[model samples]
Target: MAERHLEIEQKYDAAADFVLPELDGLPGVASAGEPEVHELHASYFDTADLRLAAHGITLRRRRGGTDAGWHLKMPAGTDSKQEMRAPLGRPLVVPARLAGLVAAYTRGAELRPVATLETRRTVVRLLAADGAELAEVADDLVTGCGPDAEPERWREIEVELKGGTPELLKAAGKRLRKVGAKKGKSSSKLGRLLGEAVVPAQAAAARAAARSRIAAATSNGKGPGITTGEVVLAYLAEQVEAIATYDPKARLEEEDAVHKMRVAVRRTRSALRSYRPVLDAERTVPLGPELRWLAAVLGEVRDLEVLRMRFAEAPAFVVEDLEKREKAAYRRMNASLREPRYFKLLDELDRLILDPPLAGAADRKARKELPLLVTRAWDRMAKDYASIKSADDPDVARHETRKAAKRARYAAELAVPVLGVAAKRVVKDAKRIQEVLGGYQDGVIAMEHLGTAAKRTKVPAEAFALGVLYGKEQCEALAARDHLSTTWSQTLGPSF
Candidate 1:
């Protein structure tokens, strides 16, 4: 079994002769305990290409520590990581459970020992006025060696919070820095060992700078003079990063993780479709179906999640059945994440960002080429809306319009950096159209599920309760239908 923890800590660089600072007078501190010494050794693992390290994840097996174990640390938030630990077992092999969490990044690549570190540490514990252990400061003298590199020695300080608040941590950092401690450059010991091999390239930073430049130009009423490929690739990279960031969270069943991952997938797929004039069809078209396939798998779990919330007040049996189905759907979704097909899809996305196959139009200025693409998306939604007004069965037409609105909304969002307020208005209007029709679609689906549940139940009371819920859902669906005309009229402000 693996135990999970939120690891919150800060690290600093220190000279070999740098002395520990006085900690008793810091905020919320009464006294600092005498130093305790320990010898620690850790072996770090990653894919041959260092994929995990590139994403700020660490997998290690450590010995001679109070919490010695096989640990998988993933970025949770600023200055914090979600760490999962299993008992230290095999000396060389990565634990199956921990490996499964990073399958999205590894994509079935073999994990191998990349670096090793041995640290001699002295720890001083900071205590509160009431004697609670608030935090621990470790002064570590580390000797690190990578796969083909010579051993390198360095000294650093680590302050890990136990029961302390962020303010206390900030105070401790202030005091440490006051005594000549410089903030650590690398995020981890392994990062310092592997050096530039694991650190992301400067190209990523350049892309971000380019995005800011384009947005600034557009905001100043000057056209973005950058190529369409630059704008589209930056947007695609962001969505792909989101997909990767949320993959492990979704696997761990974190709140809203599956929905977030699915939305990223949809955005990527939508961009590929809406920007086809600028992107090469030969390489991008096949990716659309693959992204859709992944989204459908995630949607299965996301839909059940929504229903579990919607029917929270329903009969116990009804909730229980939904919970059971939800668990099963989640298991299936998890299995799909580990499939070779899913891994290949992720690899393809990586390639698309790294070596984009751009068409002739991609060489044109973004401000000139992107607005037409966004307008085309808006036209698609308008056509679907017109079909809904004339169709006898509005359910199917509404669903089509809803999907078109989502695509248009995403398209406009992608162009906002290059089109300014004009694109933002389109985004705002398309979002309203999507939300109204989305509610109608949800009501329709809920009623169908309730009717199916009513038929499957053996007890009359449960069946009667389900029937009542179905009636309510039908009423809501009808109300949404009535609101569609009003929503459409109000949102008709933006045509692009």
Candidate 2:
């Protein structure tokens, strides 16, 4: 249901300025391009606080343009944005996905039209050396209208650089800046047209409520309440950002990008668990199960990713060495890596993410309110680690320790984006903890399997080999535990 477009549009102050003859050959009209430009008018919709702009997003309804409908401009790093348009229906309502995206920033707020503007435009083309048009440049006479009868007109240039880097933009912009073609004062066309009406109202209230909610969440259950509202909102915020950030990475098929984004899905569910007291678990209850389903759906390629990493690091000396006692030890790992169970796991992960049971969080944006589940979660993170550390069974302790690491990692991640450095230190500590526990757990499982297989085969040579591997694992586990102690002391201090 997600869609995107790489939009390229340029604005200009005057038609003359747009028509400078700087080339031996040009595109579109060849000699003199079509001067025809539609008179455009658009109504900008934003929260009273202009939440959309704060998130580097813009949404508006426009008429008189060739493509008239609702347009949502998503941030495309600096100086650019990906514009997504949804056609207006009989009801003229916003698309569900588009609205959901905005809801993350707006929170529990309303979207309304604050201002309108009209544009008189002429369009021209940028051409390659062969007279092929590379991109278009639009010249606009912006007339600020509505909310005031005495409307004002201004001139500016718009360029949608085709197949050009921001660096080329820099070069061209420098040339234009010499002639006062500096960066557009407003972030978007709607902003320039209706700047006076929207910005101030959106700034003051700011992140006030979000900050309070986050703080309360951090202190929840110890007298101060951490609302499920806080945790859920925080989780939603991160997921929305993940969706936005990973869009390009998904398009490019970056290694582990999909899986990384999928982890955000788990993190959201984990927050739900860690902060269970805040939400109507009955209402939000089904979400955990659904999250599990989705996680499975996203697991396919991710499992492959894990295997690839494992195989890359798995030493040849550790596998299939018949003359060496470690031969049987290595063979089992290699055979397990190639098993169909691996494929089954991958398939399961994919189905869940693509089609989650989203019943728990139904159209959550409107006329819906939930309490905070914050304090208990933070407290749980601390207690959970302690419980893991104190587990009687060493194997179970290792697994629980990993679980605790994940909890801490999730907490640190949510905070890092909002609180910055202090949160980052927590993430680093948690990651070190995860590494220690994970290695020990992996070694334990591997050693146990090889030991069982060797005993079943009744091969003294295989048993001896497995015993040696088992000894190595025992040593490694102890080392990991010792390393974890040092890391925990250094980063988390004695209190941890």
Candidate 3:
């Protein structure tokens, strides 16, 4: 079982011609790269209806590659893929547990074979000035066979970024171009697999960037309305990555993994409800029920974990303390929350994963519809910013700012692999706003907890302590809200 995918990198420029089909020796070369070849075969699984498309993922079982096994590929940012693999499957479909892990995206969609591919790989490595392997350039002669599409043959050279920058691709490119080893016209294997289905979100964004933001943010621009496509795609991509990144963590039962994964699930749902128009509701409307189930299950585990942690942070064995009694009740309730009820949850995830209830509608590729979607989402964000600008109440202003942050995050996440540094910078700034508001929300929750503790306590000191906590949070929230004026100004502009 080999966990494998071809990595294709295109270098921008180099000192000299680093073309392919190199002869034994070259002049003025300090060192050369070695290449090894491998035989690769992979069978990809997806619903005939394209259940995985909405989530931007593809699953497969592969053999003969360097790393082989059951592979789940979720979109990473713009152009990259986050490929997660498990050991050789005892049987196909997807292991119940493995499938359940991605239930948020798969929902009721079915999982079936969409395509199978076999490739004879020839490798050539590119090294640095130090003679270390800088990048892997593999030439793949491939055959793709599938149900919905035709069988095809293709030859491609891939330069995967293993331990180097995109800059390395440029450096290596100088030499490759001389021998006719030009950057392959396609972006990814899956992109080629889908053929005309591939959406050029980054390429679209490039064009959008050329236009004025104000023009795009308004309907006068050519894109979709705000909160429509951009937010949906962003949310879609984020959930897919969340599923892949947390897969290993969930299996390992790492602290807070369940909680973080659940948030990702919730975010996906939020995006769906938030931007219902731009997407084909026929496929997404049915998704809500399944998404709810996943969020509920994971949240239960997270809630219990949070309560357990709070209990540990409670004070000494003083019976007179009301806070102590609240802590005890919390522990007692949490103990009951972790029964067989949760044991079965992991299995539900499995059923959803291995046997999705996908309608054929989900399989349609929405790539051609990207710019309009992005523009729509940006419009909502811009409007929200305008609302904040006119807002007189600080609290109202802050809340509106939070909504804008979400829109920005949604856009950036969709373009992550595409927008590169610019998207990252936008997301980082918007996240700062989320953090400020999030802390204020935490204060509100903390105050409620303290009040509950106080009501259960007989001792005045216990009540006093609870009051102290409430007051502290209230003050914190106010200060944070006040600071937001300046923060929002910096982020959105002085008008905001």
- The lDDT, on a scale of 0 to 1, for candidate 1 is 0.88
* TM-score of model 3 vs. true structure: 0.49
Which is the better candidate, 1 or 3, if ranked by lDDT?
Answer: 1
Candidate 2 residue lDDT tens string, 1-496: 4455776543334333444334213222233245558788777677776767655577877787667877888766666688767776433466665665554355546777655768786666555545555555666778766444467677776767665445444544455555645567776766665565555422223223444556564556321343334434545555634643553343334566657767776786776565454445554565567556546645544544443343332334334322243233333422332344433432332222323223333223211222111223334545655675567775676576677677667755654433345556667777787788777766665566556556565656656766666777678867776676666666551111
- Write the residue-wise lDDT of candidate 1 on 19-60 in tens digits: 998888777889999999999999999999898898788999
- Which candidate number maximizes lDDT? 1
Off by over 4 Å in 3: 1-31, 53-56, 96-98, 101-105, 129-132, 148-150, 182-185, 193-496
lDDT of 3: 0.56
What is the per-residue lDDT of model 3 for residues 1-496, given as tens digits with 9 covering 90 to 100? 2233434354222222333655223322234566687999888776655556434567778888677778776655544765667886664667554565455444445677677889888777655566666567677777888666788777766656665666665555555666666555555455466765534333223323423332344435433333334434433544644654574455435577777777776666655654555455665676677667666656555654654454343433222343444345434433322334433433343332333333322233333333343445555655665676567765566566676666556555554433345556666766777777766755665667666766777877766766765687789877776676566666631111
Better of 1 and 2 by lDDT: 1
Q: What are the RMSD figures for all models against the true structure?
A: 2.2, 13.3, 12.0
Reference-based TM-score, model 2:
0.50
For all candidates in order, the CA lDDT equals 0.88, 0.55, 0.56
Q: Where's the lowest-lDDT run of ten residues in candidate 2? A: 366-375
